[model samples]
Target: MAYEVLVQSVVDYAIYLLDREGRVSSWNPGAERIKGYSPGEILGKHFSRFYTEEDRHADVPEAALGPSLGGDIQFETAVP
Candidate 1:
């Protein structure tokens, strides 16, 4: 699909999709490069895996699923 190609071709930003329950469902090449996890390693895992320990302890990942004023959800994380 054209969309698949576009997603895979991007290398400057990490782009991915999550399921309704916040599980990683689709991962792109950019995501693999930026996040350092192959699809095999991260698919089906919670998106919270990218968050810092303090963020996880604070439930920041779940909170990010909430509606946002700008109509876009974004957050930063410290990746290993």
Candidate 2:
């Protein structure tokens, strides 16, 4: 589909889809390039792995599930 093509072509921004439970449902090329996880390794995994320990302890991931208006949530990560 056109959307898949666009997501695959973009390399600057990581574009992915997470299920309602925060599980990674779709992994795009940009996501693999930026996050360093191939789809095989990351697909169906909980996205909280990207959050810092403090963030996880503070329930930041839970808070990030805000209104489903399709917006972005900026967070600090421990991954280098």
Question: Which 10-residue window of candidate 2 scores lowest in summed lDDT?
Answer: 71-80
Off by over 4 Å in 1: 68-80
User: Over the stretch 1-80, how does candidate 1's per-residue lDDT look in tens digits?
Assistant: 99999998898889999987889999988889988999999999999888888999987788788653234456666655
- Report the alpha-carbon TM-score of model 2 versus the true structure: 0.79
lDDT by residue for model 2 over 1-80, one digit each (tens)?
99989888888889999998888999888899999899999999988788878888987776677544466676544553
TM-score of 1: 0.81
The lDDT, on a scale of 0 to 1, for candidate 1 is 0.85
Residue 29 in model 1: shift from native, Å?
1.0
Tell me the alpha-carbon RMSD of every candidate: 3.4, 3.3
User: Which candidate number would show the highest lDDT if scored against the true structure?
Assistant: 1
Error of 2 at 11 (Å): 1.3
**What's the TM-score of every candidate structure?**
0.81, 0.79
Residue pair clashes in candidate 2: none
lDDT, candidate 2, equals 0.83
